[model samples]
Target: MRSWKRRGPTYCKDTWGCPRSQRKRVVFNKFGQPIGKIGKKFTNFLGTVARLGAELPIDQFDWRQVPNEKKEDAWEVVQDYYDVDEMHKSWTLSNIGTKWKDWKCYLRKTYFDPGFPCTDDRVIGDQWTGLYAHWQSSLAQKHSITNKANRSKQVMMHTNGTQSFACKRYDLEKGSGKVLSRPELFKLTHTKKNGKIVDKA
Candidate 1:
């Protein structure tokens, strides 16, 4: 049998008992929910699909590995994260308030949400080193860029009881070449301006 699921945009709270994530979604990594591509058939004559018995938890993803050649071509966006001190705290499930968990969830939104790959480059330094450590460092870098830009912006409320947040981007004609330097980055959000469009570049 097919498991129950919400098909539409998840942030909806309709009167028909649909669930909503309120402001948005908070990623869950504590548990794994088994999911399968196929369900049952109309009759035993057609053979029924079996339910998947296992699933890897959200945190099982390996960060140090990525498709080498493919990573350069898929080039997308510079995933961003928030650098808060709490992210360094203990993330064991026993800690009802886990900073590490919070940080991981937020970072994931930037990666997969922006169509970026899940793999990350391993950091080489005296700080911390390991699967989790690499992510912590990279996410910190992303967080700084986004946080700085956010702090520099101003939001205004309109007199008509409306509010909007818009920032102008200059240098729409700037051009830059591509390199595969590990630190430089292959994926980054598009900054195209002046109504220009790029089909494939």
Candidate 2:
């Protein structure tokens, strides 16, 4: 039996629930990168799809400018690794675009920054060698610094630690059996795991 899952955008094809046993699994290396195609985590598979399929300037390319053909191509690739149906194509396309943007930000923070162990090109391995050049470009550096400065000016920062906002919203909705309001989501996101408010002022 087919049923809609109330947890965020997870669409379950089962009547009981979308258990982990039903979903695709992914194998990861020590660096957390996917090792293969099918049976992988959705986000990692999507990340791999973006890295392999999309071709754009790493520094300042916009998703809006990406051709529909490219997105369609990406969608087809995702279908090979995920259980997503054709009915979910629109959502999957948008999700892919968002994931692509997030991947660029992550690459900048991980490879361009000073602290991470994966910052060095000599040991970054062949998979990331293509991105190493782009991250080293002056344009990428400018954008990274500008984005960092802008982020520092934001007052209401979420205290969810490693938990993503989507996951948090999904969990909250699953427990409550209803969609969360914008205000409720904001409050929950700003609250820490210890039940303390993140920004009291």
lDDT (0 to 1) per candidate: 0.25, 0.59
Model 2, residue 93: what's the lDDT?
Answer: 71
Q: Output the TM-score of candidate 2.
A: 0.55
For candidate 2, the clash count comes to 3
Candidate 2 lDDT by residue in tens digits, 106-193: 6656655763545433223543555566667798679778988998999878886645456666667768899888789999889877
- Candidate number with greatest lDDT: 2
How many clashes does each candidate structure show, in the order listed? 6, 3
Evaluated against the true structure, the overall lDDT of model 1 is 0.25
lDDT, candidate 1, 6-120, per-residue tens = 5322211121132232221122221321111110001110110000001111232232232333222211100011111222122211121122233345545656447555443
Stretches of candidate 1 exceeding 4 Å from the true structure: 1-68, 71-131, 135-149, 156-201
Question: Candidate 1: how large is its RMSD?
Answer: 21.7
